[model samples]
Target: MSFGTEMENKDFKSTFSGYSKVEVDQFIAKMMVEFNSLSRENNNLKKDNESNQEKINYYMTLEKTMQNSMEIAQKTLKFSQNQAEKAKAHADKEADHIILKAKEKAKAILDHTNEKNELLKNEYDKYYNEFETFKIRVANFIEVQKNVFSTSPEDLELSPLDLTSFEEYVLKNIADSSEEVDDDELTLPELFDDEIDHNEDAQEHDDNLVKG
Candidate 1:
């Protein structure tokens, strides 16, 4: 704002009691020209500083925005990770539940199978015992019949009875010739006549067959 070193080097002529006016006016005019130049430069520098401060403020605001974005991104990523972990845990739990249910179902199926097998075995045993008992009884009956109807081989040949007609023909013939006597029932006149009629009819059927 003040003059340059020229003002300090240049001296004014002394008048009666003060400096010369002409010289002072000339130096003052030159200092005003330089001061005006410095003033303009100072104003430009101030404008440049203000512009730089505005740019710095804008960059600081952008940094804040970027910092906020990063924080939000991190938070979102953390939230997603937590949700994924929960999903995995839930899936594992479901898997365990399914496995447990399957195991229980398998056990139930096995138990049912074992029970059915046991019941089948019991039924088989019961039927086998019944069949064995039936076989024993049939064997005893056959033995009894064998003992009661036993005859010598010669007698069997002598009396070669036809088994097809044995009940109706051979028994009557054998009884007629037997030594054992049970004459009470045979003495009944009505039954004896029925028997005689039956024998007559059988003899007539045999005669017709022979004629044919």
Candidate 2:
């Protein structure tokens, strides 16, 4: 009886030990599954971080490019403004030069006109003086002819005088006188001889008429 009891106790202890080993193996398998799940999640988080960093770098590059473009635009605008100002200054100078030239031309024209007017006035004055001198000379010639004819004696008859014959004789005498008398060399006695000879002939002709 004692041997059988000891054998039964040993058999019970062996069965319990076998169940503990199986439980420990199952626990180890569950822990391994949990560890693998955690490792996969960590790898996925690292990939997401890399992708976010690449996006931030791209945005930073775009910002730098835009800043350079803005700087270039500002420089171009300043250059255009400078060119405009230079062109305006040059145009103003050209306009002033043209105005000065026009003024000079106008002054020259006015001076020329004034000179011409003065020349014309002087010419008119000279012509008027010459005309007045001619008129005075004509009047003096008529007066001298009248005085010489009036002082002549009426009885010194050369012919029965018609108007035509008298005019012919007077014209002939005028022509002969012009040839013989030089005004600068003529003496006063020569001028009186013609009147004295005519009066003596008139007195002699009257004495003969009274006797007839």
Candidate 3:
């Protein structure tokens, strides 16, 4: 209860030897004022303590929340790092696979090219050998003509029987040699053309001698 209300209800009994009422009342009044002031101050201090306690409680809750958030953030960071590593490993594996496939494809292409080159080489050798054989045959035919043409026209007697034998042998040999070669098979060399031109000139000279 307030000191003012308590003092109003208090009753002081007067006696013959009791202290003076006026002085005692004045002292009690001063003490009541000081007590009321101290009570008000104590109430205000209680209010301040309650407010400070509330602030401390809020800060504690905020700190706990921050700790939880930090934990979550760290976990998220670790998870992201793990995912990145996995992705990098997968990408590296894919790259290696691509490189391996490319190398295999390149090797296959090289092998095929080598095989094609070998076939072409074989074809060229076959054609070259055929060309050489053809040259030899042409040389032999030219040698036969040279042997026949070496005789002077004066030395060739014009007997009917001898003329028939000479014509039959020369014509038969020429026709057989001509039939052996087909124009479509092989391309004649420049040397063949030159040799053929030379033979044609010799044959023309021999015809002139026969006519004379």
Output the number of the TM-score-best candidate: 3
Give the range where candidate 2 is weakest over 10 consecutive residues by summed lDDT: 3-12
What are the candidates' C-alpha RMSDs? 17.1, 22.5, 12.1
**Tens digits of lDDT, candidate 2, 1-212:** 44333433333244643767555556655655665566578778888888888988988898898888889889989999999999999999999999999999999999987886686577557545644543453344355457446644353244545545444444444445444333343233443454367446655754764574
**CA lDDT, every prediction?**
0.65, 0.59, 0.72
Off by over 4 Å in 3: 1-8, 12-24, 148-212
Candidates ranked by lDDT: 3, 1, 2
Model 2 TM-score is 0.48
Q: Write candidate 1's Cα lDDT for 1-212 as tens digits.
A: 24455554556667697866876777787776777789789989999999999999999999999999999999999999999999999999999999999999999999998997796688567656655654554454345336436855355554445543323333344345443323443422443465468556656755764585
Query: Residue 148's C-alpha lDDT in candidate 2?
Result: 41
lDDT of 3 at 13: 100
Please provide TM-scores, in order, for all candidate models, with all chains considered together: 0.58, 0.48, 0.61
Lowest summed lDDT across 10 adjacent residues in model 3 is found at: 182-191
RMSD, model 1, all Cα superposed?
A: 17.1
Q: For residues 1-212, could you state the per-residue lDDT of candidate 3 as single tens digits?
A: 76667975677999999999999998888877887788889999999999999999999999999999999999999999999999999999999999999999999999998997786688567656665765766765676567557765545544435755555445444445665443332323433675577556656755764585
- Native-referenced Cα lDDT, model 1: 0.65
Candidates 1 and 3 compared: the better one by TM-score is 3
How many clashes in candidate 2? 0
